[model samples]
Target: MIEHPMIETDRLILRKVTLDDAKDMFDYLSDSEVVKHMGIAPYQTVEAVHEEVEWYHSILKEQTGIRWGITLKNSDKVIGSCGFLNRNGKHFRTEVGFELNKEYWGKGVAREALEAVVTFGFKHMKLERIEALIEPGNISSQNLVEKIGFVKEGLLRHYEYTCGKFDDLFIYSFLKGDKTNRKSEH
Candidate 1:
């Protein structure tokens, strides 16, 4: 199993998932509102949450997608998750996805976590493109993608069939050398 190195940013730390995080994972991941747009459904119990965490615990150290538990510096709490996934092509492209605890809604934590993951993908992992497939009407996530310079490619009509029906996914992307963040003074 190949392990992914931990990553850090100005205010967040991206670490591998462990079964010990079941408590924090259940807190947010079991919320229907939070999981509504996610690929996975909201967990029904802490046991269910642990089931999900266990899978990531194995995959995080394997050939599978890189998943991280997003913890904040000030609180040291796992507010949510964000990571690289769904790799394709000559190991040069992958998808990025994330979710947050409702308690942190309206905050810029998503961007902080996202930018760090994107930086890891490009600057370290060497991926050529990073994509986000957001559910329609998820305006908050849509705005976050655009703010980070990912252009709306188009709507992926019924791109995914989940929760017993077809769901439209918005395809937004950022190229490898997009120059969107090259001007940063930091």
Candidate 2:
């Protein structure tokens, strides 16, 4: 089994998610605005959130990926999550995904958490490429990735079908050893 480590930032903790976090996960996952560009429908029940949490566990067991619950340093409340998924060991690459509670938006919490995750992907997982697939309309996410040094790699038309329709996605990537991969002055 792949060991999951707790990653700490100045104001947040990236720890292994547990079923106890269901309510907190539901808070953001249930928000339509939070999940608007994620393709998945907003969760409608805590039970669904439990399953989502279980998926986090399964990925680790299968050695496919890792997901962490993002919590404030002063509280256990999970305001968001950031992690690597769709990992291709043979190719030394993986996809990154993250979401934050609306209440914490624009606070740099996601960036801090994501930077930690990206570090883990490159250092711990020894991945060479970290890709982020985001909907074209998700300007916030686009800006976040760009600020972190991911270069825009054009678009993938009708790449995903969700919420009853197909949506296009913009692909962005951060490769290992990129100068911008280090702590940014911003």
Q: Best candidate, TM-score-wise?
A: 2
Over 16-102, each residue of candidate 2 has an lDDT whose tens digit, in order, gives: 988889999999999999999989899999889999899999988887789999999999999999998888999999999999999
Name the regions of candidate 1 deviating beyond 4 angstroms: 89-91, 182-186
C-alpha positional error of residue 166 in candidate 2 after TM-score superposition, expressed in Å: 1.2
Query: Which ten residues in a row are the worst by lDDT in model 2?
Result: 177-186
C-alpha lDDT score of every prediction, in listed order: 0.81, 0.90
Residue 32 in candidate 2, Cα distance off native in Å? 0.4
TM match of model 2 to true structure: 0.96
Candidate 2 residue-wise lDDT at 107:
91
In order of appearance, the predictions have TM-scores of: 0.91, 0.96
lDDT value, candidate 2, whole model = 0.90
Candidate 1: TM-score? 0.91
